[model samples]
Target: MCIIFFHFNPNSASAYRLILAANRDEFYSRPSKPADFWANNGNILSGLDMEKGREGGTWLGISKKGKCAALTNYLQPVINMDALGRGYLVPNFLTQDMDGLTYLKKISLEGHLYNGFNLLTVDFSNTKGDMMCYYGNRSDQEPRVLDPGIYGLCNSLLDTPWKKLVNGKKLFTETIKKSCALSPENLTQELLNMLNNEEYQLPVTDIEEQGQDFIRPILEEFSALFIRTSFYGTRTNTVILVDAKGHVTFTERCLLKPDTNQWKVSSYQFELET
Candidate 1:
């Protein structure tokens, strides 16, 4: 949602990997983690509250069934609803092992009576591998199969104009390019370098859009402010995938937290050796 990080082809043994960390005041009102969570979901999974019988704030989730998904709220005010439309997506993804596209089709056809929201679903269960983001509103923009590079998508449409999304993406892209130019051997470190670069150091901004001043209270809650100054927006999200040998890794960091430098909140390391 606010912060999204990933690597398309990192030249590793894993096929794909992703880690998601997000912050939201809305999660407080929702339910907590699921009971017998391991039985239904994978060994690694995370989520917040929002569903009818479930909670929200799903930073990241990975199922033993090989299904994975991470959720974040986009920073937009015009797309408001009583509840995030189909807010139950995260829990459903964790508990149910359905094909990604099949699931998306059903949700798209069935309308919702709640607030509008966006979702990124990853399905690697079969050869039909893909990643998708949805806007539960009039926008018919279907999910996008993520490319093999560093990408950031907040709430304002994929590849928006927000400083973090825009600038972050630039740094992320250049980091990878420069690394490739040096030598392909630094693939791992190169990928990490992109996620760990310091040149992206710029004080956060309280970026206000065309006509959302009145909604400052809501916007301020999730906009990017310097980690040292605020915790309203996405700190950082990193993902890496290598298909040649079937290995993957992903990590997300809470940049606002002063006490921790360990980023990979939710991660998966495995080989789909079928």
Candidate 2:
């Protein structure tokens, strides 16, 4: 499962803020267009072109309106055919005008035929921005809303408190609650702290703790031998921020190669007319 955290603050230049950190075994598939999967003429928007038959997943992106979104895959037991590809949700949220509840209800009915996945979409373009969560039917409940601040979202549930996303939550909470002042520059520093933290250590103490405990076991079990696979490991850690003014910044980290320590950072900043 992957993890996503976002901040919604209307007073800042960018009405919304977002940070996405995800850990996957690797992606070994072809590429596809956002529209080929679904159409999102809505408020939020984001997409990644699948490299022909090579598949890739996106963290999240914003739209011309004041919307933002992210998604994660569920790694639980289920029929293979039951899983629904969520490549369309990001772009849908970015481009669609549908608010939280409206989109939830519509997607619920549309997803009845599919299996596992989760999407978190937020729109602050209205008088007050709102947030919502959508899960495959087996989650035992209906879609729900999220509060403003840092949150941990994984495949299992909202704020799953898993290893990869826990430390980020802690840092974000402290920055907002304890800092005397906050700004885009400070937020970017906090993000870098998480990415540069010991990549080889355990993320948490135990299953009950809000961190990762099975670090050793997972590495031992999976890194037994080196094999050639057309997979992209941890490509980049992205950080996005949208203050009240509709300004946004996107930063990405490009790793050297598999099992390497070097990395490169690239950033993009833009503003919307909202």
Candidate 3:
């Protein structure tokens, strides 16, 4: 995940409404497919990175139990090729029977086994509600629960305000507040439109947090939300919405070519609780 902007709980009218629009920036030649792809081991749904050189894992995935997770690579000059594939973390969390806090605590120890990365997993196993927690190997802070609010994340820490993170957050928040009560279809459309935004032209930066250099140049394209470059650019855009009742709707749009508006879209819906 390169650019992810989300509204955790933008208003008081709702108990919980998580709306996330993300853009996956990568090399144009990278073989990937965006859809509700699932592995044979379980009914877990996510996109698939066909180039199996690494983990062949997914950047985001949702389990049959309504566990939702998304991961972003921590920008660094160094590469730990032997580290565990960060993409596998999402599916692993979904298949494993563990709460968000417990899983994050255990994974934090082996965080050094992989390169720096940020992982956010929302556990809805209780059937009562969902719990969201954010853990980053690069951040100095410990694995902490996030407050009820909108947040923007790119290559930097959670909300490091890298121009795009700051501006994109405002746009997403405003859209959430203005809607009366958005249906899943309506909400997904709104978020997809937001992801298609190519407005901001701010150059990417090398942000230093806690003495770590985080540099993501993909954010330097024509837009802060959707990025397009020559060799490497935004490969796919995904919109996911989960409401208070555990009803989940996921939609993804993938582009084969970087310069065309063509996209391959897929959607899935499932109830988390009876």
Candidate 4:
């Protein structure tokens, strides 16, 4: 999805080193396959993009190696829809064993191939000094290694001062502090509740944007922690928790449409490679 919130702690004493909650936002018309541990040799667990077929890739994915990646667009309006598939970035990262900084450095060399995008990659290859990085061509030319902390990403950039990002990160930090006992279900549910937050709305739309006039009228309506609009809104919410002992839990709550009363929730647990 377009928004992601993740906490990374490199401490070996902590039960969970990485906890992530995110939502995927897209137009209702775009058909996509739901998340699953895909059948094949790669064992890639992610939602398949039916539109792009095998090449479509995914918005987010985690491989068997404990490697994870997710991407968000930079909110830059580009008319050429066929420039390059930004969705491929995550799947590509998941299939490899490279460190976060190494992979990001290579991608930065080919940054011109795709439109503005912010990528988040986590490297659990090394049990000690685990690395998480934010690479965004629009936000900054240099790749930034994320320190152990809570961070939020939206359609803009890595840690941009968006209303939802700021609020979500704050609430997320508070939750982490209060739930120090490591109650997995409670903590993840708290994140899910935050994804349903509909508190803030933009008062006005920036007319400087090149060509998103269609959603301009309802821009304010879609400006909350969880977006709600008929044509475009949150389609899926995913939560992932990884403990220092190599245990991992991945969950996905899927919604077919914006106002559907039915939601399909699935959870999968696995172990990371040592």
Candidate 5:
């Protein structure tokens, strides 16, 4: 996932506990399967990254056991192509029985083995209560439980206040506040529409402002929520809503034909098995 905007309100007396929308940006040539129940692990509901060496991994996913995870790469000039595929982090958490904190601690030890990335893990099955933890290998901050509130994550640390993240968060917060009276389907559509935003602005930091000469143009090209290029762009838009009563709704819109605007949408609804 390149960009994510979410509201985590576990203490809310409202109908929903979590509301999330994310866009997965990648090369159009990278093969991927749309969101579906994995055949190897029926408990997992997520789209598969079919790229060679990264098969079976996902950018975001949820398990029937009430575990959810999402990952975003940390933007930098250098990437270790030989490093472990960060995409596997999501499925590794969802498929395990470990609590979010334990799993994060374990991963933190080997975090250096992979490219820099940010991970968000949630364990709704916790006996104490649902907990969300954010950890980034490139960050000095330890994996800590997040307080209930709105959050945004992109190609940086959590809530980094990047130009895109700042604007996206504002729009997301507004849509969420107005969604109190909307049905699940309508809310999902509204979030999807928000992901289609294509506005761009200057980078928020000097580091972000200075991109590698080779990829600098590509970097600036994706400053918007929705990015489109001949070879690379946002491949999918995903929206997930988990209600206070444990009802879950997951929807994904995948670009069927890149550069042609053709899209295929898949949706699933189920109750958390906690």
Candidate 6:
């Protein structure tokens, strides 16, 4: 997930406890499977990154046991290709038995094993209460629990207030307010519409301003909520809503072919098994 907008209302008496919308940007040629329950585990639901030799990894995923995780790469001028693929972070948390805090601590200890990335993990099955934790290896902050509120993340640190993240949060808040009384399908459509927005343009940050001039065009293309380029762009848009009753609605819209305008959508609903 390259960009995400979410609201986490753990204490809400309303219909939903969590609502999330995200876009996954990647190279068009990279192969991936659409969102579905894993054939092996059955309990895990996510799209699989089928890039060569890095199968079984995912950018976002949720378990039947009320665990969910999503990851986004942190912006860096250089990346360590020899490090672990960050896609595995989501499924690793989803399949594990640890709570959000414990699992994040574990990841923190071995953060150097992976490239720079931001990770969000949730364990709604906690006996005390649901928990959400966020960690970014590139950040100076430690893994910390998030309070109930709206948040946004992209290639930057969590809630960095990039132009796109700020605008996305506003749109997301509006969609949630308008969809309070709508049906699940209607709400999903509204969120999808929000993700399709591409008007916001990112200003050159201090780092990008100092970088070489040749990279500016690529950053300009990436500024939109919905990015499109000949070789790389937003490949998937996903919406996940979990109600107060532990019912989950997951919907994914994916590009049907590389560098094409066609898209395919898949949706799933399941009650949490807690």
Better of 1 and 5 by TM-score: 5
Q: Per-residue CA lDDT of candidate 5, range 137-158, in tens?
A: 9987778899999999988789
State the displacement of the C-alpha of residue 73, model 1, in Å, after optimal TM-score superposition: 2.0
Residue 267, candidate 1: how far off, in angstroms? 5.6
* Candidate 4 global lDDT: 0.77
Ranking by lDDT: 5, 6, 4, 3, 2, 1
* Tens digit of per-residue lDDT, candidate 4, span 4-74: 98889865565588888898888777788788897774556788777744355788888777688998876
In candidate 1, what are the lDDT values of residues 70-140, reduced to their tens digit?
55554444554455434466667656657655666666665354444455666553354444433333346
Tens-place lDDT digits, model 6, residues 1-274: 2899888988356758899999999888889999999999999999999999889999999999889999998776666879988888899888888888888889999998887899999888535688899999987788999998899988878888777778888899998887679999999999999898878465747326533453455777777789887888888999999998889999999998864589999999999887
Residue 191 of candidate 4: its Cα lDDT?
81
Model 5 lDDT-worst window of ten: 206-215
* Predictions in order: lDDT: 0.46, 0.52, 0.74, 0.77, 0.86, 0.86
What order do you get sorting by TM-score, best first?
A: 5, 6, 4, 3, 2, 1
- Give the Å shift of residue 68 in candidate 1: 2.3
- lDDT at 62 for candidate 2? 64
**TM-score on alpha carbons, each prediction:** 0.62, 0.70, 0.88, 0.91, 0.95, 0.95
* lDDT tens digits, residue span 73-130, model 3: 8777667778877888887888888887788889998888888789888866443455
Considering lDDT, which of the candidate structures 1 and 4 is the better prediction for this target? 4
lDDT string for model 2 (62-135, tens) is 66565666776654433465445565666655666678667866777776555456777766553454454445
- Clash totals for all candidate models: 26, 35, 0, 1, 0, 0
Candidate 4 ranges beyond 4 A from true positions:
53-55, 126-128, 204-215, 257-259
Cα RMSDs, all models: 5.9, 6.0, 3.1, 2.3, 1.6, 1.8
Model 4 lDDT, residue 63, Cα: 73
- Model 2, residue 151: what's the lDDT? 69
